[model samples]
Target: MKITGSRGAKALALVALVSAVGACGLPRSGPNKAEIFKGSVLKQGDAFIVTVNSRVTRATAVTPALGFSSAFRNAGVVGSDVISPGDVLGLTIYENVKDDPLLGNTGQRVSALTEIQVDGAGYIFVPYAGKIKAAGQSPDGLRNIITKKLDTQTPDPQISVQRLAGDGSTVSVSGFAGANGVFPIERPTRTLSAMLSKAGGVTIEPAVAIVRVTRGGKTGSIWLEDLYSNPALDIALRPGDKITVEKDTRSFVAMGATGSQTKVPFETQTLSAIEALATVGGLNTGTADPTGVFVFRNEPAEVANAVLGRRDLKGDQRMVYVLDLTQPTGMFEARDFLIRDGDTVYVTEAPFVQWQKTLSAISGSTNAANNIATTGQ
Candidate 1:
């Protein structure tokens, strides 16, 4: 069949019109490189960068129960006695007697003034009163024995015992503070707050502020929130007590299709999957393929195999948990999934969207070439 020039021109015009329509059907591409669809598949190593915007919010703030009780039991005695060696005890003696000028009121007068030294055996040496166990004894208890011994030698004598040296007065302050060391509590009554003040207070950064108290070898952990909310937990300080404010160590990494691709600090030991998502600004709107959200975490090989069918060949390798956010039920389940420390969250872009963008670009180039050719003729 011999084709006419006008017919050929009409056919070419029809083909161009059809191509333009098909190009119009192709998805428009802008700065956004990814799209969230109902059912999108993702492959490993695909990069999707999340856009930064003020509208995006993270779930870094935690509102835990204020009245959470500590696991420590109140077993120790209140105001327990603590005595150590090298403690000096001051003793004074008074007596009632008439004055004899030459003898200096020898019958009933203040005769002996002595200071006792606690030896290594926890015993104190006193004049005329042999070794006395003063370590566990109260002031009055030791005075009674000294007075009795003085009575046998002389008349009735009154003895007073006082602590003048404070060698054993010390408390340990540690953790998220400018200064962490063993500080001596100069005051008779020292509280936990006072110790923190002396140690330069808590760290200004919330990510590193955590205070823990250990008294007489017992451990108790307290959050910075508890320090402000629950004052009752911030109890008074005692001798031989240690206060530590440890820097928070648990954190999650947010990367790939998140506004902020960095480590997010968490106060709690474990963070929920939904909470982690929120911390990363809840995925990029135009670029994130929610269905491709995944979390990569390291776990024990045995446990990983039991839970995720992963083998031990990788030797402590991380397990990948892929989450399909397209399904309505995925939202609920995602909330239950917990994220551990060092876990990485990634959101990918839809593959078809990229194809559509490529097709659109190719069609646009073809149209530009056609227009240039027509203008040149």
Candidate 2:
């Protein structure tokens, strides 16, 4: 370990060069504590950085409310047996005459009429009954109308009408459903939950599955599981309604020195900071600075005002929340802190990491110099 003046000076020179290069730049997962603070609102930066506290956690701990609007909730259950236009009706006529029957041959007192489709104008035609409105009329109501129409023509005409298949009282189901098709809305499938069951239920995980209902140009969505927990969410189905079962598209970006950096999806309806971190495999034990955990989000003006206690900020405000896991209540705050969709969770590297990298560079440089000198000798 004894080095002469020239060799010692050369080593010192190499160390200085490495230190200068390290000071200039070093690879990092993301901006460290100092760099992040430099971009704070106080520093005239775009982001407003605030330390995570009980108030901050409470202010930001919110998930989107997944439920139906008044239009969807206020809709009353429809009668599944009600007739509508485009419906197929099966009719059978019974005659009391022993001689000549209006709809059958002599001695034959019965006549069958299959596929009597209701027109777009809600009219259905029987042989002698003429055009009769069938839409909005129940099967029995239509039967009575037909009998009355044929009363003056046939001998005590009796009629029976039955609903067979139709494009009217049916819903179109698509997306993650087990069976994606148009299903008839019958007595058993009159409600949202029942209709979903008729479609073979959702194929995705229920915890994150979303059911969207579109009716008359208005759309409402709710968590598929919420349909059971909240009875109001299971609204009655209507004809021409479109239903889609989709997986939750909400996700957060995981970056910096923690686990893996990618778009982490929401596993549950509501996600917290702790859960989000866990989803990304937690922090990198060696490089992650426990005190430099941060979350970046663009919050609405209303939420920004509540969090920062300011009313002047308008539009979407850039918010950066700092979490010091080393504090006594830090872990609790993280557990309570909600991670909204499109948020980012980042952890800075420990300060000593840069120094270690600098030292490694210097050692590598010195070894290379020594090898060159030995080779020359």
Candidate 3:
């Protein structure tokens, strides 16, 4: 097209403006595939970039293996009805002799001791039984011992011992349980799962719930859902054990051209790359480059070696894995690929998105120039 008069000058100025915008580069969601490749360790960058493939997917498909250790699983269940220190025992003694009963008056043949508490030293003192070891003995066994101890003092002494309000043989259940309190260990609540039930079960979703058992100085954790599926994980509970039901704390970050950029927590026990994308609202359809999906993570040396097929890498290695959804098996690879905690899932913008932005800037400049040219006319 031929331009004349002041219009020609405005046209030239418009061309210059467009050139300036292109030279400065248009704003974009993130670096494109080529730019990302330029940042690879092979190209003097800090990250070792690898493409997502079936082999890579298999190598990186590991999830957090959470379960009770042998220390917890091998523990045998103790008798929940056994007496322990700090337990309160209710005792009632009956004497056959009506004349001058040792533990009762002449006319009284029954003596009721409603509050006999086992001391910290595992001993309980009765009126005529002296200091007797009550801990580790069942209620019936304790009754027999008390009866024997008072046999010499009273005639045909018969004692009955009943456990009332145990304080020692108990577990403390807290954190996301339906009820948070110290629960006495009974026959029905001797195992870890049973103790959790005695506390009214976990209040949160089982898939994301974590059950932790802290006994003595060691702590073991397991997924709540696994407790039922794997009976071996339903470890036996011990006295003074503390059980806590908590939500899973694993999370990943979504950035770049994704539907939303935020730190998303794992809703299920195991999360894959595709599921993680869905959790963040998926990719930005208009700007996202389906071939430029990237996951950034600091992998341990062993994982890094397996993924890279190299054993030279040491410590935690910075790795970037690329996923191309445009490929035939790309979707399957993404579906199989696992997303771990603290990973960053980024989707770069399509190459044409930047070109489109540049065209928009040129369109604006053309309008401005035309208006100026019209005024000059």
Candidate 4:
């Protein structure tokens, strides 16, 4: 990290904190004093460029997002769009001939359909079979179980079970929606993107959304951009599952020599430094110190220290991120540099410009002195 002024002291302190990262988990001070970084000069490799997984590490849940995965684990049942526990199912038994007390001999081969509620236990009580596990089980599984149970009493007994209510035909969608509720699924139109559309679609752009699925106590998450890009992940929704959509909080701040210095929210959950730079209107070619573009962020001391090529130093540390954008591979490397939330990005004023301004001030002062003498004469 390169520092030109009193900021060098803070930069070294941060470097020391990372170098000492191995010594222990020393509590570091927060950036409460604006002066610590208010006018601090930054270089390309300061402790701030992000290299972790989460898009926004320093984000304080600013417009924070919440998400969940589907509630069923079985890929089989979940895929087939079958009903699970907490759902209503309808069943019918069929026999070859005459009226049987079990079938109530509807004269026809098939018995009347009966609707039953699947309890929280995922079990449904059949007339003769009593309570049987139904949650996460497929329609075929239910049919086979019921058939086996009645096989002994009747000759070649046949049974049919259909998912009446539950994940079988509906999925609950919530968040940033025109109407949040369970949407009935149309056959062949049960994918996530399709389901969201069925609910009148999300109000915000899905590409920038954070979506999660909670299923079987296990939750999975992905950005809407990824979901939209990957067709396979929009898996079938199982009964008893919930999906939540939320606005993306992942963002970064652009400061120093940019067209506009401001906080820029990521258009998509995942973005690169180059993309981030582009989003903020790039640097001011007229005044920006090209070599001084830097990103500032707090990072895991151990990891930061490891990258800086040293052993534990002391205290806590935030990184001063830099890149030699002039290099041929600069753009490629920048593309790999992921920007996190609350990250401070700055483009230093060119050294030549600063010198020129100083010289101009000196020349103006001399001219004023000469002019005062002439006026007095």
Per residue, candidate 3 scores C-alpha lDDT tens digits across 210-246 of 9989999999898998898989899998889999999
Candidate 2 local accuracy as lDDT? 0.89
Question: CA lDDT, every prediction?
Answer: 0.61, 0.89, 0.89, 0.65
- Candidate 3 TM-score to native: 0.93
* TM-score pick, better of 1 and 3: 3
TM-score of each: 0.62, 0.93, 0.93, 0.60
Q: Is candidate 1 or candidate 2 better by TM-score?
A: 2
- In candidate 3, stretches whose alpha carbon ends up further than 4 angstroms from where it belongs are 1-19, 375-377
Backbone clash numbers for all candidates listed: 2, 0, 0, 24
**Candidates 3 and 4 compared by lDDT, better number:** 3
lDDT of 2 by residue, 5-113 (tens): 8899988897788779787776778788999999987898999999989998888877787788888888888887789888898999999897988888889998999
Candidate 4 residue spans exceeding 4 A from truth? 1-83, 91-114, 121-160, 167-171, 176-179, 183-203, 228-237, 313-316, 323-337, 351-377
Rate residue 33 of model 1 by lDDT. 24
Q: How many clashing residue pairs are found in candidate 1? A: 2
Q: For model 3, which pairs clash?
A: none
Ranking by lDDT: 3, 2, 4, 1
